[model samples]
Target: MTAFSAIHEEHESDKEDFTPGVEPQPTWCPGCGDFAVLKALKGAMPELGRSPEEVMLVTGIGCSGKLSSYFESYGYHSIHGRALPVARASKLANPGLEVIAAGGDGDGYGIGGNHFMHTARENHDMTYIVFNNEIFGLTKGQTSPTSPKGHKSKTQPSGSAKDPVRPLTLSLASGASYIARTAATNPRQAQEIIAEAVEHDGFAHVDFLTQCPTWNKDAKEYVPYTDVQDEYDFDRTDRREAADMMYEAETKLHEGEVLTGRFYRDEQRPSYGQEKRSTGEMPEDHLAERYFEDDPEFERVADHLIDRHK
Candidate 1:
């Protein structure tokens, strides 16, 4: 059988026992933004009609990192600022799997900042969800990469001096195929954005503005809610317009004036999987056969490559 055929058969066999069910109760604090994000994810997963076995959820260190344990799917709770590499490797290893990389702002945009930029440029087929709560909740409320200036936190005891990172603008600038922003409080909108991200063929990222009541009680002036309506001129889809909006939003702290929606999408770029296939590589089953039939020297090389690297 072809490698693709064998992998398909394996997936089919695994799906026999797969069933959609409620996710485990989250371990986040009450009113945590992660809770709403988790709920929106659960609501979106079933709509995709994908079996749990076909899905792989990879998360990073932080309150959002705990998501792997709460979902009923293949999961990996990776180290801090490392979810992107882990998720990228997972997708490359098993291209058939529907991979979703998730983490908090601290884990994704802070220390893991480099991975975010390259991953967007790579245009891999995966959905990245960043719950941007502004502060590092898991580390006991330290100022995160997206923490705005003057926002006090454990790390920034006297309020942050530097401006916060604008993730949406960065993603757009980094050539992300799909980019979006959403608020955790708006569950319906969050779910829709996530669903769209999942359906997008290339690297898709959703920056979710989540609330951190524990650390950001005073930073409520910047948080977005479903009920609040602020005047935003979304009249243009040009890149310059998007960049301007990002700059304006970051500079001016207007209450109830957050923009939440798909900011950019480019479907022209080929996904990593498509590129690999186009290069005439054998399908999954053939690759597996090659691995199993290869001599011990090749086996040793494979072992060394996997063990010594990454």
Candidate 2:
């Protein structure tokens, strides 16, 4: 298990373990791909034997933000493009929660791009799933960072002149230790990829391709997809090979050929948490537990900080 693994009682888990007691029905439109993400995520938890209490899901503002509400876990529905910072802070504090940050393309690649890049560069111990529907589904179908060049939208009535962001390539260049892409159309693969990402020790970035039927009418349904693992042979650990594959995959997507699968993985690199601990910068004891310890030393340190600040 990685540094992020929680010390929970080992037992069998089921998909239903992630379902809330109240179980509010999903409001996503019929045939919406976000539904597939939710279903696949639920299916993945049991494979890792993770209970709801061991996980933390943080989401940014968007239709995808509703994920925090639906999933039964310690969840935070954060403001637009801010889920990463919150997830990062939580993981650093506890170092035991299985933190997962989520957001739509606009929420992540557009407004949260800087945070995403730096988090990956630092090799944060968490999984980040970006729902790449190309266009912003919420806020009335505006053009997003991942929107295809020449894509017509409410914000770009004449057609967007900017090229789509290559997420896989960006993740690799930004120093993510694990990188993968999966589409909602392939639920089994999506579930498998999510499980792998969660288990990875370093920054794991999964660019999830979802279709927005209500807004992105011209976008492909992400059907007839090619799983790179099954179809192509390459060394995922080799930066050059991974870069080549990611570039090809990014190019093919806008050209109407959908390719998805793991592109890069480097397990040897230490996660940010591990580095902090090794340097004695971060306390070995989980910070979240310190508040309940009632130790005199802890109070003395707290009082010293408060007095210094005053």
Candidate 3:
């Protein structure tokens, strides 16, 4: 099997003890955005008023994916770009769980981009946090999907010619119920936004601008977390206005002039789980049993195989 599949299989058997306390120290770089994101999520958990068992953290392959092991909750460290799908399925299976999907720009916007768009429109009751550092740190500093054009990296030594993907704008256009932006340096703001996202009833997407000191140093120096200020027209809730703000912030060339705050929140649409329950189908308490009973061919094959083995 592939290395990724092996890691996932190993993770399935490794059960972490769920104890209540401060979040464990992270293994990321000293100034990495992941540190702040982890802190923010840890701080927000108390406000959520949910037990560790009630929350589920799912993450894709990347720096942010390590978050699954840091939190004192049920966590799924899935394959690259598959965090959202696993998180969505978990939430559907147990609608009471507060599911959150975390990953880097490459994992979410590149490999998981299609799933991201569909989940937003479906309005799943979950929160998606993308740590966008513009470059792939794990792969020895390669240009990622969100890397700015002309930014030099290991993959593009002469600077990339393709324009970076604007995650906020794409999220806005994807019909996300809630959209927000924050800098990983601003722990307070990140905490607040994460709390709000968990509280949001529909699909929530937060684009967290993270700094990768190892890669994209130029961009990192340009937008130091402390340099950014929470600036946005909070009074504007119109979708068009939010879309405009997302575009401007993404395209603006000023250093540390990026806006940070909640851009959009719409609670009009019902979540997928809610809509599914409305179909009048009785919920199955024993999914495993139902699966075996509904497929006689599989059951018979399994019995025959067991008999032959015996």
Using lDDT as the yardstick, the better of models 1 and 2 is 2
Quote the lDDT for 157 in model 2. 93
Question: Per-residue lDDT for 160-216 in model 2, tens only?
Answer: 999999999999999999999999999999999999999999899999999989988
lDDT (tens digit, per residue) of candidate 1 on 1-310: 3333333333222222233355456768887788777777777766766656667899998888888777777889898889999998888777877899999998888889999999998898999999887788877888888877787777778988998788878988887888877887678888888988998899999988788788777555234443212455553346776677766654543344666666667777898777877886524432334555435223455787888887
Clashing pairs in 2: none
Best by lDDT: 2
The parts of candidate 1 lying over 4 Å away from their true place are 1-23, 221-238, 249-256, 281-310
Query: How many clashing residue pairs are found in candidate 2?
Result: 0
Predictions in order: lDDT: 0.75, 0.92, 0.78
lDDT of 2: 0.92
Per-candidate TM vs. native? 0.82, 0.95, 0.82
Ranking, lDDT, top scorer first = 2, 3, 1
At residue 193, candidate 2 shows an lDDT of 97
Give me the runs in candidate 3 sitting further than 4 Å from their true place.
1-23, 221-236, 253-256, 281-310
Question: Which whole-number lDDT from 0 to 100 does residue 301 have in model 1?
Answer: 56
Clashing residue pairs found in predicted model 1: 3-285, 3-286
